[model samples]
Target: MRRLIFWTTVVSGIAAAYLLYKKGVPPGTIASEVIANPVGTLIHEL
Candidate 1:
């Protein structure tokens, strides 16, 4: 349902923000890194 999709998006966005915070990177920087290699970005995040 639409409500479920909206909630999922919101939760995922929050999770991503937390991950970026922990990694000491901004969301915008992560987004740009993702453009090069998503896997590398994830590894760097971890």
Candidate 2:
């Protein structure tokens, strides 16, 4: 259960970054968001 949510959040974050990349969002912004997103999600989950 927890494992599943963790993986899902990770995959979703990556997918979001990919979409942002495809939409021409800058790499620096995407990189920060990608790194921050999972930490935010896990923090919220707890």
Candidate 3:
């Protein structure tokens, strides 16, 4: 059960990273967006 959770997290993280890369979004940009406007970002995304 724990192993399943671990692998699922790992796979999803890799997939997210790949998608972000394809979209040309830099990691620093994402970090700054979250840090600068967490609530606004969440609302906009939703």
Candidate 4:
């Protein structure tokens, strides 16, 4: 259960970074935002 959340967050972060990068969002900015709020970013993306 715990590991699930961890992996989910990891995949979510990677997906977010990919999408943002495709959209021309700066990598540095995406790194901070995704690192700062993985769950929130995932939920918001949903």
* Per-model RMSD to reference: 5.2, 5.6, 6.3, 1.4
Model 3: lowest-lDDT 10 consecutive positions: 37-46
Worst 10 residues of 4 by lDDT: 37-46
Q: Which candidate's TM-score is highest?
A: 4
The global C-alpha lDDT for each of the candidates, from Candidate 1 onward, is 0.62, 0.72, 0.60, 0.82
Error of 3 at 5 (Å): 0.2
Candidate 1 regions exceeding 4 Å error are 27-46
What does candidate 4's lDDT look like per residue over 1-46, in tens digits?
A: 9999899999888877777777798888889989998767667666
For model 4, which pairs clash? none
- Candidate 3, residues 1-46: lDDT per residue as tens digits? 9998767655555555555556788998765665565545545454
- Across residues 1-46, which tens digit of lDDT does each residue of candidate 1 receive? 9998767655555555567768788768766655555444445556
Candidate 1 RMSD to the real structure: 5.2
After superposing candidate 2, which stretches have Cα over 4 Å from the reference? 38-46
Compared with the true structure, model 1 gives a TM-score of: 0.57
Candidate 2 lDDT over 3-37, as tens digits, reads 99888888877777777788798999878877878
Candidates ranked by lDDT: 4, 2, 1, 3
Candidate 3 lDDT score at position 44 = 49
